[model samples]
Target: MLNYRNALRVGTASCLEETSVDVSYEDGSPDDDDVPRRAIVAVLPPDQETRILMLTTYLNLARCASHVGRNKDAVVCATLAAGIAQHDEHTDHLITAKILRSRAHLAQNHLKQALRDSAAATELAPSDHKSVQLLARDVERAKRAALRANKQLAKEVSTWVQSAQSKFAEQGGNEADCAQQ
Candidate 1:
């Protein structure tokens, strides 16, 4: 039986295994952010190099899965991306993680969940950018759509309740007893 940390270590190792062959020098540096893809991939330990590639690869693959209506696959990819990104705890990585999670929910047909996450990401970002604002507005639209859907569901439920009440009344048509009912 492995502990939680060791289990995660194993998971991260599996993710990094793919990139190990290419990254000849693994220094386990936290300050590797200057090297673009290399930097992101190098954040993990030497043994976990493949896991980094797996994480990034899944992030890219999630979008394609969404297009093909493979929602379960999309969700799996996006979730992996978010989890890996969040592991780093860097601000940019957190933003990426939030977006990945949001997109995964969206792909799974959970627009409300996506909107909530997008809103959270917008608030989490420090600066005002056009893309951030756009995401925020998209979240608003998702909220409206979810509200409308809820209202429709409520109406249907109300109708069913009324129908059931009428049926009960018709069956128990005795004056005093029915009135009490």
Candidate 2:
């Protein structure tokens, strides 16, 4: 079993090399090809370390996707990372995944979802991690800004509707007539 695991790791490494894909967290230039990394993670044994590694890979993929302006793919990868972390009861990975997912949501303008994920991350993160705390705070500010924008939009729409209604009334058209049309 140990030999098989080693062989699998070696094979995955070779495949990654062949694909020239770097799914490292610190890698500024990530490869566009994520299939090899995904395949390796899919075949990893259901062990604690392997699970953590898989979550890490997913997180990296999410980051890469976001960097490439693929917000939808980033959200998908982050969601996968979060799910795996939750299933494996890996608190650190869970926090990391939540943070990543929150950022993805923010990028996609999913303010509510971003707020929720950021709140979860803040709750799960340790007090020592000041960076995560700051991220959570930033997310909170973004959520507020989104809420304000929505409110402003609603007010604008209401005003426009009222103006249209007044114009229709001037043209001898009632609400019922407008509804029928």
For candidate 1, list the clashing residue pairs, or say none.
Answer: 15-50, 15-51, 16-48, 16-49, 16-50, 16-51, 17-50, 17-51, 18-50
Could you give me the TM-score of model 2 versus the true structure? 0.63
Tens digit of lDDT per residue, candidate 1, span 1-181?
0012122111222234333312222223222112222223223434456656766787778768777777767765665565556554445654665666676676566887787768767877876756567666766776787799999999999898678777777896544554575
Whole-structure CA lDDT of model 1: 0.57
Model 2: which ten-residue window has the lowest total lDDT?
Answer: 1-10
RMSD per candidate (Å) reads 10.2, 11.0
- Model 1 residue runs over 4 Å out of place are 1-52, 167-181
lDDT tens digits, residue span 38-127, model 2: 334334355788877878899999989989999888877877777677666788887887888788888888888888888888888888
Worst 10-residue stretch by lDDT in candidate 1? 1-10
Among all candidates shown, the one with the greatest TM-score: 2
State how far residue 4 of model 2 sits from its true place (Å). Answer: 30
Q: Model 1 TM-score?
A: 0.56
